[model samples]
Target chain A: MREVAVVGVGMTLFGKHTETIRELGEEAVWAALQDAGMSPKDVQVAYAGNALGRISGQEMVSGQMVLREVGITGIPITRIEDACASASFAFRESWLAIASGLYDVAMAVGYEKMTGATTAQIMEALAGASDTELEADLGITFPGVFAMVARRHMYQYGTTREQIAYVSVKNHDNGALNPRSQYQKRFSIEEVLASRPIASPLNLLDCCPISDGCAAAVLVAKDLAPRYTRKPVWVAASGQASGFFEPGSDVTVLKPTIAASQSAYKQAGLGPEDIDLAEVHDCFTIAEVLHTEDLGFAPKGEGGPFIMDGNTAIGGRIPINTSGGLLSKGHPVGATGLAQIVEIVEQLRGQSGHRQVQGARAGLAMCLGGFMHSDAGVVAVHILKA
Target chain B: MPETESTENSRIINEKWFTETPQGKALAGSRCRKCGRTYFPRKRVCVQCFEDGRMEDVALSRMGRLYTFTVAEAGPPGFTLPYAFGYVDLPEGVRVFSPLGGDFARLEIGAEMEMAIGPIRQDDGVDVIGYIFKPV
Candidate 1:
């Protein structure tokens, strides 16, 4: 396959919005095109990631909506939805398309307007990705499932409730530096631990808030690099895996993430030890710790202790979630994956003014999606280099 | 009177109550003849094996382990909160998601459980009889 490099990445601030989903995509795409030193006309093919638009009475094709606005049409545009990893998969697809010589330049963007949906509608849509008979039938919501995992970790690892709140606290610390973060207000551990419980043992702060946002990226061949930007972050490797979807399998750990990450590491010719920084899918506080362990950044069951060591801060051994991750970055499902790419791009490009990881070389981005029946629908990992 | 059907694959679809035979008497399940896979609520076609006909009837074990569980403090508006929910991994190699009855303190893994079905919940003003596990 031909080598692909990310020429530019862009995203909108995460929060409530009056703009339509198409507008969100348009905003990000416009910024990304400007960053790539090109317009919508430069994109030969496009892919957009969106989880729900029809529920709000806007169905049809998503590609046409945004592309039509940008005055670029008649080219291939597809919407991909793999839950939270929706945008990352789109990024992976764009990279492959360019790398395979099928397209010299490609654009991938993810947008989600989740706050528009009512609470019940949101729950049903989220549950639609789960096992119908096993989970949906019993009205088991996503928070309930995540709470199960958090509770299991708490029981097995003796992880206290306060430590769990610290995850949000740490993420918010980074969020405070991030103007784009949703919850920029810093919270204390006691405040988080005292928050009302959404599910048993899972306080409100333990869960990432539903958010609205969009993120986009432009990928092209390394040979065509300097044409778009002077310094392009090289796409070293990409890997993805799916696991069995049954509660019979254990939820204490993520098997798909481990497998996907290993494959990515093998392809990149680098191990987890070489990663200077990372952006993990912390849809929940526990998810960050689990992903850290599953990605081999830490040993088994040592993730809690590893985070407690303060090694994931800006100056730590491997600063993580410099963009505040889903916890503070706001998990607008479709937008989350691409947002991770944007954060890593910003960090690698040395553009992260305050939250930048000094001398960051190679970085890893892990995206996990569709936790159903104890199985993660897809786990995608990408290694980027400066 | 003896039912006289020992084919290990025959059962009436309308049999609301479970049939208890002399030798084997527990909860009966349907087995897909093509793949030999079993399911608690018998169906015409097995989700697996992709084969629809010639499914056999069998009995499931009376006990299972509490795979993973939680006390859901908040659920749907109509549904009551603070209910114990979990999946029971049966000895028959099938995992069943159900509610735990009696006491939450005693809900432990590898606990013996028997199915108790009743109007455990109400939805849209309709009574729904669901299954729950009781420590046996």
Candidate 2:
């Protein structure tokens, strides 16, 4: 396969928005195009990711509808969805299109308009990401599953509840510095622990808020990279994996994340130590701990203490979620994956104002979609280098 | 026929997932004749060995050990708030997900748990009866 480069990336402020999906998509796409110093006509192929548009009333041809707002027409526009990992999968496809020599320039846009839906509607929609026949039908919510995982983690590893709450505190601290973050306020561990309970050991503060937003990126072939931008972030590797249902599998470890991140590390000819920073799927506070361990950033079962030790904080060893992550930045499911990519791109370019990891040469972005049989249904891992 | 009508009215959430054995009511599952692996809620094929047509119906053990659990303070429409649920590891090595139906304070990991049939949630004023686990 040929090499691909991320020439530009952009995202809308992650929070409740009155704007339609089309408007949000247009804002992100146009910003990305302008950042790439290219026009809409330059995009040869396009992929759009929107997870809940159908539930919000845009059922068919959402890609066509969104792209038309930016005057991007008459191209192969495909809509992709894998629950929360929708945008990362779309991004991987865009990179593949260029890497396969099929298209010189490709664009991926992910948008979700969730604020328009009611809370109950949103809960029902999000629950669909799990195994509907077994888990969802049994009235299991995402927080419930993660709470169980947290319990298991604590039982097996002796992880304290305060250690888990520290993740929320650290991410919120970082989010406070990010202009695009949904919640720009930082809270103490006491406040987080005292927040209203959503699940035992996991309060409302530990969970990511429902959000509406969009994120986009432009990719080009290696040969065409210089024409778009001087500081192109090369796509070192892109890895994707699906969950395997094993009844007795360990709940503390995410098998798909390990598989995907290992595949990415191998493809990039690098190890977890080489990663300067990461933007992982922190849909919940406990999730960040699990991802940290699964991605090899920390030893298995020690993710709780690892974060509590200030290892994951900005300016610490291997700063993580510098964009505030899904917890503080808000998780707009479909948009979350590419929104992660947008953060890594900016950090790599040394453009992130306060949350930037200095001299960051390499970064990893990981996103997970759904849960089933005690595992993530899908996971996507991408490595980027300056 | 009268029992069938009563069962229908009872609205046992999923009929295929349970069976009445001489021992008692047990969760109906599938055991792969080739690998000897068992799965709950049954499977058309052995996901592990990918062996098709070598599956046989098996009754799951009614008793298990509480593996992990949590108390969900909120949930979707039908579930009563602050309900408890978890996974139970059975002797057959299959971990089953079930709603816990016992004293909240008595629930603990590694404690003995037994499968019980009861109303899991409400659906349009109807109790959706399904399998649950109670601390023993």
Candidate 3:
């Protein structure tokens, strides 16, 4: 195995867009290539991550179609899908291609056009990520799943609704500093609490909006990284795991996240205390709380209070979601995982202006895809160092 | 007689999910004869023991405890808004995801719940009957 480094990262402003999926993919890819100081001809292999292209009328050969716009052809272009973690898996594969000495330079792109579909259509499509026959057919929406988890967490640990609502308040404040964020406006705790209820214990403000966007990253072998950029963010570790179905499993802790994060921490020869910052999956505000604990940043059942105390805020003990997270930054499904990586890369390279964690050297990114048997169906955890 | 044959305005959501035993309508599940693990909606093989042809059909308990729940204000197509659903932990160690009936406010964790069959939602002018849990 060899070392891999992220030389370039790019993302479109996450929100509603009239641009086609291919066009969105092109924008991010072009920006990434430009950032890396490389042209399309420099890429050896490409991986594209997309979840709802079929719903948007682009079903197969998504990678080929998207890369064709950037003049990236006659190469091994594979389409990867793993629900919301689609892009993260794509990045993992790209790292593998370089680490295994199969390719020196590889690119990963994740794009999703969710705005074009109807609310019902989009909801139905997102629900497909779960056990369609067992859960979706029973009409359990994503919010409902998280709502149940929030309720259980509250019941088990005395976590208050106010503490959970505080997560939205904090992330939106960070998003306000990010020009590319979807919802740049910050909200008060009372305002977030008073927002229209989507599911019990979780209001509208607590949920991430449906969005359309794209994010891309360029990775190369460590030995060749300095040729493209002066500040290369090394891929310390990349870990991915799927859920195990235990009927009576605890809903509060996502086992796959723990499994993946443990694998990542071990590979990186680091612990949670060593991380200077993190970008976790906050598809729902409660999700951030869960990931905080699952990633070992907070003790189990203490994530709500840990976040409520401002421990995870920017400039706090360990800043989290400086990119505004999926909540305020907007969750474009397939594009979310790579967007997280983009934020970490920028933070490590001292590119994030106001939201930057001062003197940060190491960062972590965690993403969850789908819910199954009362837990996340898939999880991916990655560690990056400056 | 099979429950589906007796109803005209409604039908069970999945025919293989329920069985009419002497004790009344009960959830049909598969038990791994090799490992004694059980599953709801049945299974072709035991996921725990990974033993083929070592599974037996069994009727699940009608009563269980509410593990967790939520009142969903919105859901996918065909679901009525503001409906309640939850996980019911049965004595067989199988957690069943079922729609909750009766007063939503009264639904509490660790509360005893009994399984009941009713219309869960409407599908193209017909009631999609399925199993539900009501406070006992």
Candidate 4:
């Protein structure tokens, strides 16, 4: 296998976009090309990740549709659908393409347009992320599953609703600094605790908003990366794991995330202690706490205390979700994973203005897709060395 | 099913789910004969030991505690909003997500809970029979 480096990363400002999904894809790709000091002609192959809402399911072969805009039509393109981890998996595949010597340069894009779908349509599309035979049949939604985890964390650890609210409060503050962040507003812990309840412990303020945006990255061989950029974030490790289909795993402890992170750290010859910053999948507030613990930033079941104690704050022991994460950055499903990579790239390059972690040397990002049985259908983790 | 007997009334109907009495009969699941791994909805193969086609039918404990929960401010198609639901970690070590019966606060984490089949909600005039972890 060859050494892999992210030569360039770019994206459109994540928020409600009136532009078509194809246009967003083109914009993101153009930005990446510009960053890479290359053009549409440089990429050898392409992989795109796109998901459909209830009514948005009408569109088929999303990769072919978007790649047409950039005039890279002939290169083999694959459309990925890994729920929220769609683009993350796409990015992973692109990394593999470069690492496995399959391609010297590969284009990875993640695009989604939820502005066109109705609320019901969106919920129905989300249901597709679950097992069609069991959980979805029970009308279970993603928030519903996380909510159960939150409730369990509360009971087992006496983790307060305040700790969950603290996550939103902190992410909002981080999001406030990100110009590309979809959510520009900030929330107080009090505001989160008093917000209208969505399911139970999770309130309206606790949930991430639906977003429409796209992000893209261009990966090249490590030796060739210097030709494009002076600072290419080296891909230290990329690891993925899957979980049980039934809701059997302890929600209080995120097992799949731990295994995936551990595998990634081992592969990279690093540990959680070496990470200076991270962008974890925080689709919900509790998800962030669980992620911190699972990724070995904190001990098992002590995730709540970590948050309450402000250990994950930007200036604290380890800055997390520096891009506002999915909670405040806006979760566009298919594009979220690549978006994390893009943010890490920016932080590494010292391009992130206000949200940047000072002198960050290493970074980690994680994405989980699907929920059933005891596992998150899939877990993807990656480490980057500056 | 009458609304009183049913727990919810969501429109999407799934016939695969059926009511089970905890004390009456054991619900069918799969246990890895070699590795002792268990699966609800039962697996034909053991995932842990990588043993193919070696699972045997086993019964699971119906009792457990409420692990966590959330309410959907927005609901799925054919389902209503503000519904109570969460994951229940059974004594057999299986954590299942199900609707919570009665008040939302009663669905506390670590609260003693047991499985029951009841209406999920009313949808298009049909009551949905879904599983839940009601406070014991």
Which is the leading candidate under DockQ? 3
Give the best candidate by lDDT.
3
lDDT of 2 by residue, A1-386 (tens): 99999998989999999898898999999999999999999999999888887565796789999999999999999999999999999999999999998999999999998887776678778889988878788878888889988988999999999999999999999999999999999999999999999878699998999999999999999988899999999999999999977778898988999999999999999999999999999998999999999999999988988899999999988999999999999988889999999999999999999888999999999999999778899999999999
List, residue by residue over B58-130, the lDDT tens digit for candidate 4.
7777677866666677777656666766667777666665777766656665789776656676556776655
| Higher-TM-score candidate of 2 and 3 | 3
Q: Write the per-residue lDDT of candidate 1 for residues A239-306, one digit (tens) a residue.
A: 99997654367787889998899999999999999999999988878888788888988887777777
- Scored on chain A only, each candidate's TM-score is 0.97, 0.99, 0.99, 0.97
lDDT by candidate, in order shown: 0.79, 0.91, 0.92, 0.80
lDDT by residue (A68-132, candidate 4, tens digit) is 88888788898888888888888889999999998999999998888767766676678787776
Q: For candidate 3, what is the interface RMSD? A: 1.0
lDDT of 2 at B100: 93
Tens digits of per-residue lDDT, candidate 3, B1-136, equal 3434436666678888889898778999999998999988888888787899888999999999999989988777788888998889999999988899988988999999999888788787778888889999
Model 1 chain A weakest lDDT span, ten residues long: A51-60
Task: Name the lDDT value of residue A49 in candidate 2.
Answer: 84
Looking at candidate 1, what TM-score does chain B attain? 0.68
Model 3: what is its DockQ? Answer: 0.78
Output the worst ten-in-a-row residue range by lDDT, candidate 1 chain B: B5-14
The sequence of per-residue lDDT tens digits that candidate 3 reaches over residues A222-326 is 989989999999999999999988769999989999999999999999999999999999999999999999999999999988999999999799889999999
| For model 2 chain A, the run of ten residues with the poorest summed lDDT | A116-125
